[model samples]
Target: MPAKKNTADKKISKTVKKDIPQLYSPLLKTYFSDLTSANMIYTKIVRSPITKGRIKSLTLEDIPEGYFLFTAADFGEENYVETLDIQTEILASSEIYYKGQPIALLAGPVFTDLLDLEKNIKMEFEKDPASKIKEKEYPYAQRFIRNGKAQKPEEFTKLFSKKNYDIKGTWTSVLNAPSCNEANGAFCTFDKNILTISTPTQWPKHLQENIKRIFNLKTEEVFIRKTISSGPHTNTIWQNTVIAVMASLVAIKTGKTAQLVLSREEHFEYLIKKSPISIKIRSAVKKDGIIEAVQVLIELDSGYHNPFAAEILDRLVIAANNIYSVRNIEIIAKAYESYTPPVSFNIECIDSQAFFAIENQMQKICNVTGFLPDELRMKNFERKFSLPFTFTNEKVREAFSAIEKMYDVNRKFISYRMESKNRKIDIKNLHNFPLRGIGVACGFNGIGYFGSNIFACNQKMEATLESDGTLEIHALQPSASTLEVWKNTAAQILEIDPKQIKLNSIFDINEDLSVPENVYANVSVMTYLLKKCCQDIQSKRFRKPLPITSTKGFTSAQKKVWNKEKFSGSPFFLSSFGAVVLELEINPYTYKIYIKNVKAVLNAGKIGIPKIAENSVKLSIQHALTELVVDENLHCDQISVSFVQSDNDPTQIDGLISRILPAAFTSALSQATGHEINTIPVKPQHFFKEMISNENSVYSK
Candidate 1:
């Protein structure tokens, strides 16, 4: 073997720059300008009409000769849309799996020209009239298995039997309404090969990959830049990206940058929405209110293909027990694929169901054996932390305690019940006016991707000591947190002023770096790693402990450090725990619900950037509320189901108020009046209306 390279010989004295003025950086201005311009023009798209049919003939007539057309045929057969390691034809080639699938793309010099041309395109399809697609056949793990033998059907069946449990409770939620009336898109051309495609997106890398694949070029040839838009929390991922890709392709093909915008009708009609779910739980409890076993089955109307059906099911299975210690647990999660658009994950709905099951069961046990819900929960709460199987952090517990104290949960519970008994709050208020009810939910979400899968990051940070003593830091990504890490680590190593250090452009992935483009759940972790590595390098350069920058990778080891899978420890590099309490009033007559106030307590490690952290939490709550109550729909292929109405906002029906309480508050609701809220978007009046009419309840808890 050849001799190993010498570290001492490789070391070089690189001079750093001083006070590099970045305030007027061209890249920054251009980036912002490009984003702004892209948002001005609206882009619209027309999709194929057939589902599960072949494109026998597609004719473009009575349109401009210069118009550009793109289809699955544009990209080579080797290129395909990939997700979760599964590759499928991007544009339907021989057949379409669902309606509204993109088969052909058209673009013109003007937006109207594109729309006019779309009206003229003629197509013929041979539909599988006898086909009846079933949803339950598609298992979440189906894509992960390469061969038919990876997992025997019996294994899944056995696992189901072994882990099964019962759940008993009712959960209700109200979607925080959505604003779909105003929807549009725009694009601009920076250069031939480099175009800054901007739209609402949750997964930037995935969109970038799709663009690269569609263009049939290397990943370096195309770049995707993200801009702040409405959260992609709902179904913006597929809808926005697909439309953007089609528009970008048109611009590239026509040799004139194009902008394809969508109307609100088109946006809702073509996109996917959240699926409504109903879970029935039954449990066996010990005399001490400890759960002996749980049995639960969830019915999810995923609409079309159930893209997130499997993941949702997996989460439900894991969440059945909550933080309480149970001897045996069993869960059955199933999805029903319908003609509607595919439903995405609704976190609030799932949490509500799980909490309702666990909490209601606690209440029932309390009634039978004489105990309080809180008393039982605390009695069975896990005292020790475990890996993948269990989640109970010290900070989470402290956060909960703080919230309880701030909210006076015990006092409220007693006071509310006494008041209700003494003077029954007019039940008519449930229908006629905004009725108020308080609710609290406490839980922690795992930070990284679920399971034992390895999460990889290829990050590098370069620091140069300038002749003027100022340090310039360059990184692969624009990590605001990583800049702090570099500052802290470098300060200790070089004994220099943190303010003197300046951070430069991040490695542009579209230009230089290459790695899988997926959302990094814990971006802070990456920054932390970079900081530690840079600090080590600086220390070694100054003749301190050890050597210069060090590169390290981690994988999920089999050893259980905390009595759980090792992967669980990775997120502990940092953790965030919080609780939310919502107060709502329902109008029984109008079937409306009004949010009165919200109190939340979050413990973020060290609070690196208070503003950003607070904003993130607030945004997360907003997104969750929209998903839980918004009047949205999804189809089979996991696209949004459209409606004839222009306004899709849920707030249109009634009064809605939202307030954010500090992290010092912690508490759950003691009681809620009106119809028993068992499902999300708790429209108690709607339920009462249906019940009074002797109709099946439209809302399921």
Candidate 2:
């Protein structure tokens, strides 16, 4: 059900009805999927069939007059687009990096005609003698921040050697591929060495730069406009560039307009996956249950090549424990390249999996020390282990307390914990027991603007007061839902009617950003930046001339506060805290898990549009639920979300639900099954294997 603005209605409920997407999205038809012209031609790529290899030999047939065939030879050897500083060939010239690497393009007026030509293109490959997977890890990051300065790994080594650690567990997660409804493609036409293309992308400036480097075109020569796309930002960040470049290549060489869109299967197959991570944590705790010394290992499988490996590894280490005081801690995180699809950050950022690993580790602490889940969490939640490492957690205790009282969390957990213990005592006849468990986890998300490409895209905002007293704003067009919110904000700030505000779509400035709508993670930051611009215009409306243009910079305060090198300081743009109480029950006969109820309390700051914010959080929770406990039979009876009423300023909230829900869901399932269930997407086969291997497994591994 779509949320109403009443606080009383925000309670737990059952559901089998799927959430419906907003019916109308402008981006779905911006370039218009119906785009077609008689002068347009379709292109099909000839791909390498092997995972790793070199092109040993090739043969080709003659192309008809209207059809065109091109290869790497058509472009120079130096032609390639580098994503995140890693160079990838536009078309595989000598060696293939992965299976389905494009080797050639065949274009024709008819799409079916091109398919026939691809069959006649003969190709031979020599498989690599060496293995594709390597034991080495690249771009490694290690940090041990303790006592106000960076410490060495040996400090934790000495502590662990003395048998002082009280809690230990290993958690691994696999990122499930997100579902996309619309296919991504581009329409391109290169005339007189100037290329004009319409496509959607997360990083527009990067795409322009890629085109300039490959085609040797000037900055002003390439013109980019938005197109039809509802895909995830993880793919659009780099994937759109590949399609645009291919279509442009065909258009320039054939002297015909070209439209290229990946088929649905191709889009999903080639799309980037979040790096699957395995986190191992060991902690030393006092008799009263305060964590003092800790050691963490993060084994991240960075599929193909990720430019942000260092950032991913660093964020994982920092989020090992949320808002806790760990006096002596050491972190070792290594990223290894693999043969699967490349890994990219999720729409919520890359911290979801890391938060899952640590929160579960915290639950492990609860089981051994006999401290209630919330008791251990709130006791040491606010204390800082070190000044440099302690980022602000806005309402860590408040959110948890709200959900605890709203859902009667303590009483239910005590009951479930007792039931879990009873089942293990009667472990031989587990089928007779009604398996039920509840999990509680608290975490915060603080992704800095620098963490995403919004800043690197050279994002700038402008507002002009027209001579007719109507305000005109030049900015990146936001999503349909947020567009109205932007207008209302500007109108209120200037005391002008919402009808008088005009938003101009920015395209191809050649120096700054023109990102596709909602591609960036932090919508609140974008709105905040726009709010600042409107405020400035409101301040100068009387003193300045009839029309004043504000070309001012809109960089966030985080750039000054964050230190990316040291991996400390206030690296997050703003922090939003959340606590989830998730209940799960298992079917004794089928071995399938279903969500019973979920109660979440969030300190999301002041919500701009309560309905939109509520719907967005619910959708994020649903997506994250698919990541951990996907089942056709799985239906959540209640997923209650309530905002903290204390904060005055608005913080980022839309994507934070996904960043925190997986941890709570996984923790709940682990307790319910009474095994070391530290994996994701809990399949039926996995449950059988887990039970068969460790029928005697307990919480204290």
Each prediction's number of clashing residue pairs: 69, 3
Candidate 2 wrongly placed segments (more than 4 Å): 1-28, 31-33, 135-150, 161-165, 191-194, 385-387, 427-433, 451-458, 514-521, 551-558, 630-633, 689-701
**lDDT (10s digit) by residue, model 2, range 1-701:** 11111111111122222332211112334653467777998878777888887887665657666777667766675557777677767787878767777887778889898888788777877898545554573433334444423265565556654444467888878765555556777888865555677776656667788887777666656666666555554556676787788888787776778888777767766664454588888888777777777777788766666656666666776677667776666677788776655665554466777788888888888877778888988777767445445566766777767776788878877888887887767665677855788888877777444454333423466788899988887766667777787788888898989999988764435434544345342466666667788888878888888787776453555466766666667666667777888888887667777788877788867777887877777777776676665454355757777888754557777656766777787778778877666876566677667665555565335
Clashing pairs in 2: 13-637, 13-638, 14-637
TM values, all candidates: 0.69, 0.88
Query: What does candidate 2 score in Cα RMSD to the true structure?
Result: 10.9
Clash number for model 2?
A: 3
What C-alpha lDDT do the candidate models reach, one value each?
A: 0.46, 0.69
Give lDDT tens digits, candidate 1, residues 1-701.
11111111111112223232212111222222234333233334557676666777776655555455566655546435555564545566766666776676665545677677777767777887524435457633321111111145453334333233333554332233455433535464535445556554545566666775666545444555444444333345444555666666555544455666555555555453454556666665655566555556666665555444555555555554556655444456666665444555443124444544444445445434544534666666774433235553344455556656666655655554444333243332233333344554444443333342222333333466665666666543344554565576566567779898776654345432332222232354444554555565665665643323355333335123222232233322222334555555444445454455555665434544445545555554554454443352211111111111121110000000111111001122224342234455433345445434532232221
Per-residue lDDT, model 2, residue 490, is 82
Q: Please give the range of 10 consecutive residues that has the lowest summed lDDT in model 2.
A: 1-10
- Candidate 2 is scored at a TM of 0.88
